[model samples]
Target chain A: MDDVTETDLQAYVDGQLPEARRADVEAYLAARPEETSRLAAYRTQRDALRELHADVLAEPPPARLVHAAEGIRGAMRARLARWGLAAGWIVLGLAVGATAGWQLHAWNSPVARAAPGIARQAAVAHATYTPEVRHPVEVGADQEAHLVAWLSKRLGGSVRAPRLAGFPLVGGRLLPGESGPVAQFMYQNESGRRLTLYVRNEPGSGAETAFRYAREGKIGVFYWIDRSFGYALSGELEREELYAVASQVYRQLNP
Target chain B: MHAAEFVALIPRLRRYARALVGDRASADDLVQDTLERAWARFHLWQRGTDLRAWLFTVMHNVNANRARALRVHSEFDEDAPEAQFRPAENGLLELRDLERALADLPVEQREVLLLVALEDMSYTEAAATLGIPIGTVMSRLSRGRERLRVLMHGPQAAVRLKRVK
Candidate 1:
């Protein structure tokens, strides 16, 4: 009652003061008419300002803002579509021997996109494999050392074949990549479930990062960059199993 | 957020915009620029974060840049004869008293007051939007209100007693 402050009154108006303190302010104001008049004027000012601007909240949002956002999103979609079409043509040109060298360079081109590009590479790899029984791999798991050495030379970085003890190694090989040479190590579990480990160098800067996972079609890719080599383990394996492979790959390459 | 989701938040953005820029037209333009930038950088957004805050941050930065350009333009035009105003036929306020009172406030004080009182931002939100701390927001809001009250009523208090007698 003897020591009320302006801050306390302002906090009361702002509904920030605790209930007990607010009650004290209210009691003090009731006994002091001059203080109450001042408080009333403050409240009147607040109300008038609110009245002046509150209606704006209910008004329609300006069309220009909406159009501006739509325009940007539309442009992004268009740009992505154009890139997708060019990629499809190049990837198609690769399957035919006439444009193999040029198409191989296109495949090895370093362009980062959301999901579709990784999915396309994975689909192409899957189609090339799964059918080959005799020559699915150039260097099989029996020669793990030679396979790793050959891929390490082609990829221009140390390469290790991640051991999937639970899943038997079917075979492995090197392929022409979008950015450079690529490696695919195929594994199959007792249930006839097959998984592919895809490796390529990220085009350009070679900034290696951690494993990234994306599921495209029946295949799940756990991709990561370690020492400038990018690896993607693609399969229909469960998320836990995929992480298990990625963890082993991360450990061996990193260690 | 999608374009539709972002579009829905534009009214609140406009309120903040209008509070930032005194003129409605300029505020709308600032908001438009903010929305465009937000959409372009939408892919860069990490999932499950406060989109409203992100939008406000963009709007605040864009407004600051626009304000800088405006300040430069105003500086060069300061001595130009056309820079002086004759009252237009269609100013929204009838009583030039409140308008004069608002103009009398320093720009910083005026900005803090409009952001809090008109835009209804909590001190934390206002601080974040203004790129200041919550304590500063409270101090600015309180000081701005105190100044506005003095400007609006100090002369009137003296005049009122003289007329009553």
Candidate 2:
């Protein structure tokens, strides 16, 4: 028989001993009344401890704890959803890349020549507006016609908000550009992520219509100059997502 | 694991905390702090492992840090007034004696004993939860149980014998 050590006795009392070792400990205890009484006392102690806190197990947890748990679960689900959206964007980028080789070709061209100053201004406007909670734009999307008319009058050209899928127009605000007033139109998704479209009158600037990308810190700008006005889309989004949105803006404005 | 599943373990956590801290308000506060820390670092917890053990480990660290901070602020008194036995209104006198005895055990030994005895954790789980070796856990358990027995019965019997003598 294995030696009935103190550790084994403690384990035996806690009901953690192996079945084979249990018989050995029991046989060892049967002959020793002193050990038997000690083991009984240990058993009684365990029972008393359990009985002392038994009421706690039956009580319902507090409301604050339940709410905190629910909040965590909600945040986790939001993270997973964001990941899913990113995966979908990757797949869409591949499909867009297949047909949009012209855009990829333009990607290699000198983006500095396209209009670096406009890209910087657009990124600045994005950074300023995206963090606003109460008033993201000067005029809300509820007055879309009035907002379009007002911005068009300020920028000296008729500007239209692009109807990007999944990004609803939040509104527009006018800001001072290097040479003139610029119209900044904002859009927001369901998750509250904001994207801004900056339009400034570039009457004398060369009409280079190729879509170009520039990054200012974390903000990505996809800017292009059409006939009379320069349009730049800025957002804190993946390059592909910004590119996709910029493409929609170009198609809608040119069409 | 899902947050609801984590919430489901609260009763067990509360029971263990109550036994460890010996008070309702402080035990619930400990559990609340544990939940907050656990959620903030939820990504660190690997899936498919024992979540209960992970939580207990977090609670052990939280409690230890609090105890350390508390000791720094106040004198370490074994017989502090708060540690005095408050008999439950309807609880038996013997159980009240047991509570006092349990409270009187050294914190290390008491934690190990409660994990093994009240929480019904295996020696391995208690060791893992407390971040101590299994051998240390065994020694603490042996010492704790023996100390508890003496505290519960020895003093009274010895005083009676001394009076008769």
Candidate 3:
């Protein structure tokens, strides 16, 4: 009963055995000291290897990878702005040259600049607040009306709570903004993985709207500027899941 | 796959790259190259097939090309083989020591070993990923595991093998 071949034992260790052979393999292992020790060694080796590299998956992918996924959106936006200025100039029947000049100048000015990192900030806020066992959000989802009214009032706009598919509104909190007040909306799945929508009013964000993407570690953020408001959605999920949630938020707000 | 879906695989690719190259800089470069290559040829990737397995196949081919350019060969230390691999009484090898042993494994053995052990791929998946026969994958895994145990047990690990006359 102990004539187990080396490959058969290897298959057993690797979990490649048929159900019928499992008992025979177990019996063979029970009778053999040397083979048992080796199997123990193999399993331990596998565990150690996994432990050493498991952290890699936890950390975020680098910014270059994020930019690659974004597919030249920034470059295209910068180029399209000039043509847009020309079109807006003639369509609105304003001072075409002057408006075009101001638009071009505004593109260079601080009005178009939002300090380059609302996405990272959103990701950080989500990472910090989402894990809270007691106080994840300042105003719970139970106070949905009050939370929206207060946040919108403070930001001087309508800051609505988004209802994403498969993720209910868990709650929300008021976070200190880069300049003024910021509102963070938290949503959670059944598994406890959270998604956060961060919004704050930035006067310098200009009237231009752009969809931007950034990844911080395992977190993926789809952030955009719509007129004076900067909105971002952060989640640990991969692209497709996060995009679905982002689309929901965008539609709810624009509607 | 969508670009974002490709982005999601970056971490897994990076981890495998680090394991394969045994250095951070080279691994990062390898990952970047793999992503670029995958993106360029993403249309070729049929949907519904396992993305992870397909990615591993790409990585294996990329690694093969890189190794061929470097003219690298798997020349493991051959001073002692069967004698050094005999089971020892001690079972308390350090994890760090095991990692070092893993790095010392021959490249071919290490690849199959990691595909099976670290990545937990089935033998069929692993063979397809490496573009090798299932038998070759099994043999390499067997050799790799033995070598890793002996190395972790320390350089002089040995016990008498029983023989019947």
Candidate 4:
């Protein structure tokens, strides 16, 4: 047909033309051998390009990409969990209000408020230092004895770097915290994933609590206060892995 | 939409990026940037819409911005398409030639071609992803395919003779 346009022919090659017009383009190409060959060439080029990069699809995606994807899932879950916590607090507050209105203030205790701060600080610290290639830590693991001693002195409390099974201590650093100096011990696994232990001297922070999780972007923090010192273990590792590492840190520190 | 759905598109994204960038590491970096931005702006994306197209749109913007920034610092002339796609010295392989030809295309043309040819995107989807009109997409596709053909196989004078009729 005289109406068969170049776009239609191109669409034909791409299989993008609507089914109703396909036969028309085929008939148009039947008379024009050159157009047929050109379309054929275009098809071949498409196939060659696909074939060339086909291996990329087969190759497993890099870990960082997966982590980034998982980060979105984690971030969303964290947001939902945060909303759930707030909803839970509201429900508890309402029940408490019905029983004794004056007790509502207790729910907003200083310790509950302080936990998030520690997790946020730890997450910020982890995000800041984990990406360093040449200098991930201030005091290298070789000087673990001095590193711990220096951190313990600056933090105004005795602190020991936890020996994680897969993650060897890369070193430790002292950072400015809301209350005072905070000690951050860095650890790196065989695959170059880094985790940090953030310890702050928070006296009168109340009784020890199990690991509480907080996520900031890609970084996840599992933090708690034990014996008046706030401890937050931060990493990009999954919750279970970080939890297991935090449990190890707790055992080693208390032992 | 769920992040799992986004994650599932990674393989296709990687394939498209690898073809688009012509280098594995840079391609992965592009995908990474794309995913990060998409994740950050996930709220803006409407549910039940084509997530793949939306992700590609994010990638297209990211890539265009990067390319613009790079052009400012680049020493070579981007318009010198002929100089860029010169055949390799050793004449190694046909696939390499195709790669070079694809790379040498103007970024706009290359994008349309890859979206249509490699990614199997419809003209409308490619247009939407690149934020161009569908007519522009078709024109770019036509020009890109012709240029690619010329680059891959020297000027087709014989084919042109039939067109003169």
C-alpha lDDT of all candidate models, in order: 0.64, 0.76, 0.74, 0.78
What's the distance in Å from true for residue B136, model 2?
A: 0.5
Clashes of each: 4, 0, 2, 0
Q: Who is ahead in lDDT, 2 or 4?
A: 4
A115, model 4: CA deviation in Å?
9.1
Q: lDDT by residue for model 2 over A88-118, one digit each (tens)?
A: 5556766766445554344434332433578
User: TM-scores of all models?
Assistant: 0.48, 0.51, 0.54, 0.55
CA-based DockQ, model 3: 0.21
Model 2 RMSD in Å is 19.6
Tell me the deviation in Å of residue B63 in model 1: 2.5
B-chain TM-score, every candidate?
A: 0.64, 0.79, 0.80, 0.82
Ranking by TM-score: 4, 3, 2, 1
Tens digits of lDDT, candidate 4, B2-82: 345666889998988888888989999999888877766665777578989999899988888898878742343323433
Task: Looking at model 1 chain A, report the run of 10 residues with the lowest lDDT sum.
Answer: A204-213
Instruction: For candidate 3, report its TM-score.
Output: 0.54
- Top-lDDT structure, candidate number: 4
Q: Is candidate 2 or candidate 3 better by TM-score?
A: 3
lDDT of 3 by residue, A46-162 (tens): 778788777878889787656544443343444456556645545554454446555555554542354356888999998999889898989999999999999999989877887
Query: What i-RMS does each candidate reach, in Å?
Result: 10.6, 14.6, 8.5, 9.7
Which regions of candidate 4 fall more than 4 Å away from where they truly are? A72-255, B72-93, B157-165
DockQ of each: 0.20, 0.20, 0.21, 0.21
